[model samples]
Target: MRFVRLAADYPVTVFGLTFEKLLIIGVIAVFLLGPERLPHYAAMLGKFVRSVRDFANGAKDRMREEMGPEFDDVDWQKLDPRQYDPRRIIRDALSDADPFAEPATPVVARAAVNENSAYLQRKRKREALGAGDAAPFDSEAT
Candidate 1:
């Protein structure tokens, strides 16, 4: 037996950068910045990262506060933008139809009306008369 991994099972990489690649980038940055400016830039980068982290955490906390208990009930995976598909959305909406509710169009009346239509009447007559015979071709139609 073989195990198939889903898309969600794979670990996501930022710009496909590994630790070795990031170390190489850091070395290049250090050479470019030099020892003097490197410390200042590193401190600034740390501060920027901390601020961004705080901002994200604050937003999450704010959302939790606003939503109250419903925040935990939200299906985060379903809301992911990557999984979004208009066809899937429409299919789900259609599948969630109320079984007990009345249909938008009356099936019996629609069928009766369709049987009375001139086109249907002609088709039925044609089918009944034709049986296994080939359909009559009109050259004028072409």
Candidate 2:
């Protein structure tokens, strides 16, 4: 039952090798391959890993370019799993308010109407007075 539980819950790790085991294998490889040959092999391995990484990066860049505007417009930083969910936050805020409720009868427009009327009256009076009449006269009587 215990083994079954381990197999069911953690199937992958159950058969995985540890770091110590990998170290032992590397030591054995060095012995078999010899110290001098090991450096050359290690260099070749490093080059192989670098080439594979470069190829992968190039492919990714090419794919992104080919996808054109669709992929290009995506904001990778916003899409990151670690970022907060904006939709959920907005939904929670909206749910707290009753949408069907009539918005407090919009503040009576009487105040604005009065202000508008006063403005119009002043504008009309200024227009009727004409620009010359609106000008100030000097007491010196030039």
Candidate 3:
């Protein structure tokens, strides 16, 4: 089975909460708590946000400490999940080894020989068939 990515126009979400959904939640909270209690709850929310921020900063600091100078040398952008593309990744991996380049080692030479033979076999089969003929199909292989 294959996975499909969402369309570009799809709404951005954070933990399944979109901007509209967050606005709705805020409105509901204001109505439920009323003006008198809203300030108290808002203050608590602010404290919670501050604590979360502090916790994240602390974790980052701890990681920096553990990683030492290497932490600053890291290419953080390359590691971001937002830029991920399975097709691009697979293409890059496949292209990393230049197939046409001279194989310096015995193992790579053998691989190139095998690949060339496979290509030749496929080419011969195609040439054996007429232009109008469909390629041979193996039901058992499927």
Candidate 4:
């Protein structure tokens, strides 16, 4: 089965150019290049693209030759940059994880302090001092 990549998968897209944008670019190019020189530039662009494809194919062939036919058997997907994305990998792995699984212990335990008792004492003192139920005031804003 062919792996069809979804557009949403591309998190680092630039411009996110669509057909409308491409058409707008083409119109702008024609205006800047002018009708007289447009054909010439178009031909040149085609030639440049063709040369790039040829160069890429040549490089792949050279790599295969140097590495032997086993190079072609390499799992290209495993070497993909997305495979190294911690967030995406973790999300996929945990998508089907048991929701009822026991929680793991904290790596670094904090002191067993009774924070609620301390807070209650502070609240009582604030109330005895006629402080409002509102949060503590900050002079920074003023």
Candidate 5:
């Protein structure tokens, strides 16, 4: 994954494509389409992407309607594609609120610290084994 700064404010992580991968794609496009046809191909690709985006927005709107008044105030446009999952959102919203909400005790805080330390140790071991190096594999690869 690669991080890109949007509007110099928000950092978005993109899952695919590297500089080398982009260079290879450009080279292949040049070879296959030639200079004269490249612009037309690019325009077509842009249009296709726009159409898909429109279709997706339309589908989401329909889903929002089907979901009803509980989600009436939710703004789909503000949703982050990376962090948003509709089912999870709905599940969380529908879950029962704490009837007896109380301040955390010292024991609870100690237990949380112990759990976090154990998690950090496991994460360090995984990193040492190079298990975190796996990149997302494209299913379209031949």
Candidate 6:
């Protein structure tokens, strides 16, 4: 008899491991590990698996404690690699370029002339000793 478990990311499967695949892996392991040493190695493997599960659970609990219920509400599927289809991306990108929309370069072009603009004349004179373009980003200002 085979037992099936529902996975949050993969439905109708248990971490993508099936009974037949596990059986084949077990057979190969028995051959490689040998019957005499199989039990000892299996015990160690079990311990490692338990530790890994415990660590993952502990991390998840800690994250939940810090992030609150919103942590679980995060859309995990959006981060999946399968969601990024290049063909779909290119199509969307092509469609997103509105034919009637103004060009994006105007802001950058305006910024280029801003150094000599009336409002910045005083600052420009002061900074004339060492004029350099400073790109400032404020994370907290957001």
Best by lDDT: 3
Task: Write down the TM-score for model 4.
Answer: 0.56
For model 6, residues 13-113, the per-residue Cα lDDT tens digits are: 45698767888888998999888999899999999999999999999999999999899899986776755657646755788687456545434333356
Better of 1 and 5 by TM-score: 1
Candidate 1: the clashing residue pairs are none
- Candidate 5 residues 11-119, lDDT tens each? 4333576667777887998899998999999899899999999999999789878988767777765674755556656755776755345423335333335645887
lDDT of 4 at 93: 76
How much lDDT does candidate 6 score? 0.73
lDDT of 3 by residue, 1-142 (tens): 3344545556878789999999999999999999999999999999999999999999999999999999999998778676678785676577767755654443433333564588789988999999899989999999
Off by over 4 Å in 5: 1-15, 18-20, 72-142
**Deviating ranges (above 4 Å) for candidate 1:** 1-25, 90-142
The local distance difference test score of model 1 is 0.78
TM-score of each: 0.48, 0.36, 0.57, 0.56, 0.37, 0.46
Off by over 4 Å in 6: 1-25, 97-142
Alpha-carbon error at 93 in model 2, in Å?
Answer: 29
Whole-model lDDT per candidate: 0.78, 0.70, 0.82, 0.76, 0.69, 0.73
**Could you tell me which 10 consecutive residues in candidate 3 have the lowest summed lDDT?**
103-112
Q: After aligning candidate 1 to the native by TM-score, how far in Å is the CA of 112 from where it should be? A: 33
Look at candidate 6 and give me any clashing residue pairs.
Answer: none
* lDDT, ranked from best to worst: 3, 1, 4, 6, 2, 5
Runs off by more than 4 Å, candidate 3: 1-12, 96-142
Mark the 10 consecutive residues where model 4 has the least summed lDDT: 1-10
Scanning candidate 2 in windows of ten residues, the lowest lDDT window is 1-10
- Cα lDDT of model 2 by residue, 3-120, tens digit: 1122234333323865677778888999999977999999998999999999999998998889987887888766645445566467657776675554443364554456458878
* TM-score, ranked from best to worst: 3, 4, 1, 6, 5, 2
Compare candidates 3 and 5 on TM-score and give the better one.
3
Better of 3 and 4 by TM-score: 3
TM-score of 5: 0.37
